[model samples]
Target: MTTLPTLTLRDGLTMPQLGFGVFQVPDDQAQQAVESALEAGYRSIDTAMIYGNEHGVGRALAASGIAREDLFVTTKLWIDDHGRGAARPALEASLERLGLASVDLYLIHWPAPATDVYLQTWQGFEDLRAAGLTRGIGVSNFLPEHLDRVVGLGGAVPAVNQIELHPALQNRETVAANAALGIATEAWSPLAQGAVLGEAPVVEAAAAHGVSAAQVVLRWHLQHGNIVIPKSVTPARIAANLDVLDFTLSEAEMAAIDALDRGQRTGPHPAEFNG
Candidate 1:
């Protein structure tokens, strides 16, 4: 099994820098996909309530034969589960669905800026962390404004902030803000949903490094110090994604990819996602 590099969160929790994501995966197929990923040396699994595949993921984890301490499992609290009263039960439900005693990380799935309830949702996460139900609690799809509110609470802080990030949507401001507060940033849609896999810069970098374009993109995230969860159902791709730690990209090559940023987005704006 290949060993991926690890990153430490704000609360001193360490996570594999590269993990497997189960987005858009069907409920029935999640188990098989996760099984393949585990065999390919992925110890971290990222899922969400909205994904509706936690049960299948749980089944795979149960059968992985890997000890509980050896794995890092993360699930999110969906928009509907936001606020003080709803967050605890939702997390318990997620654990029930995952068939785990506790999740390594739990996140607020969205800011839901229109609803203005994320502050209360974050409070719930703080409570969960205090109670030890979740090792670490954080938020996803949160911009600087949302994060600032959490910080203002004073009792607890977000350990990680998962968000959509790729060459197209660099999120430099958010990254800076997270760094400033000692919060770790994790990248979802790290490959831009495969949109830039064939781009000239990424292809050239991959060719020079003797790796795949997908690996090149993932390496970019690692080099930038962001935790990344890249999803692939294909066995070869799953193995290939974890094979990036063996090589290094030159500063010039990394710069080329950085310059390719257009500020274009492949997902919905965080502020606009009501759900």
Candidate 2:
């Protein structure tokens, strides 16, 4: 079994650097997919209320019989639940769906900057953390300016910032900004939804490493110090994704992939996305 490396958050909590993501996974299939991931040695599971699969994920966790302490579960507060008053109830509803006493981390799903309530939402996150509803709190799809505001005025620095990052869309500036603030940078779409795998540079690196292009890209994420959550419902792919820890990407190979960035994004822009 491959043991994934853990990244310690600014709050001192540890998370598996390579984990499983359940985005776009249907509610009925989430349980089985998550079970496969857990069986493949993935200890961290990322989900969101918007995904509408929390109950299924919780079912898988309950059925796996895995010790609660050994698993790291993360769920996000949806865009509809952005206000300070709505935060706790939203999290509580997620907890109910997840059938867990508390999640490992809770993140604001998006900055929804146009709404102008993320600061209040951040405060709610802080309050939840203090109340023990979540071991740690963070934000997702948040730009540097959003992070700056939340940290500067919200009275707490986020422990993590989950964003869409891949070889083709490195978002280096956001990653650097998070690094400067001691926030863990987490890559949500680390493979670019299969875009990077077909890139010439990625293919060459995979051939040289005797690994799959997916592995090459995932390894690149690890080498670059970004926590990655690659989504796959296929058992073989799920297992293969976790196998990235075995190979090391050379400096030249890393740079070649870095050059592939064309600023393409598969997800919505943080600053402009109100939902």
Candidate 3:
């Protein structure tokens, strides 16, 4: 089994650069998929309360027999739970569903600027971190403006900001902002939900490396220093996604894929969401 490379967070915690994501994974299949991923050498698992499969994920983790200390579990608090009052209970519920005493990382799932309470929510996360319920805390789908507000208000800076990033939507501005703030950038749709796998750059790179187009894209993300969580229910794909560390993409090829960014997003915009 290939050992995935690790990225260091601002707070000095190490995260597996490539992890398994359980977004859109059906409730019934989530456990089996996660078990397969763990058996395939995945130590990091990304789930959320909104995904509605944290229980399944918990089952898989318990069944894997891997020590809790060896696993890095990450879960998110949903938009509806984005306030100081709602934050702690939401995290507790997530921990209950995950069947874990504490999560390695906790995140505010979305900023939902219309609600305008991330500061309070962040304070809740800070409280959770201080209480030792979560090893580290962060946010997701937050924009540059959100980051600025958090910093300007003297709130806790997130260790990471998970977002919709792929070859089609690189989010250069967000990347720069996070880099400046020492926040690690996580790529949620690193493979574009498999939408960009057929692009010429990806396909050609795959052929050159004798690997799948999906691997090429994932490798591209790794080279760019984005924490990538590419999801797959198939055993072979799940195993293959973690086999990216042995190969490297050239600068020219990386540049070609970099040019493929069109600034399009498949998910919702953070600004207009109310919850």
Identify the leading candidate in terms of TM-score. Answer: 2
Give the C-alpha lDDT of model 3. Answer: 0.92
Clashing pairs in 1: none
lDDT value, residue 232 of candidate 3: 92
Instruction: For residues 93-148, write the lDDT of model 3, one tens digit per residue.
Output: 99999999999999989998887889999988899999999999999998999999
Give one digit per residue, the lDDT tens place, for model 1 in 1-275. Answer: 67689987878999999999999999899999999999999999999989999999999999999999999999999988878999999999999999998999999989999999888888888889888899988889889988898899886888889999998889999999999999999999999988888889999998898888999999999999999999988988988899888888899988989987887788888989887
Runs with alpha carbons beyond 4 Å of true place in candidate 1: none
Give the CA lDDT, 0 to 100, for residue 218 in model 2: 91
TM-score of candidate 2 relative to the true fold: 0.99
Task: Report the Cα RMSD per candidate.
Answer: 0.9, 0.7, 0.9
- Comparing 1 and 3 on lDDT, the stronger one: 3
Deviation (Å) of 136 in candidate 1: 0.4
Clashing pairs in 3: none
CA error at residue 269 for candidate 3, angstroms: 1.2
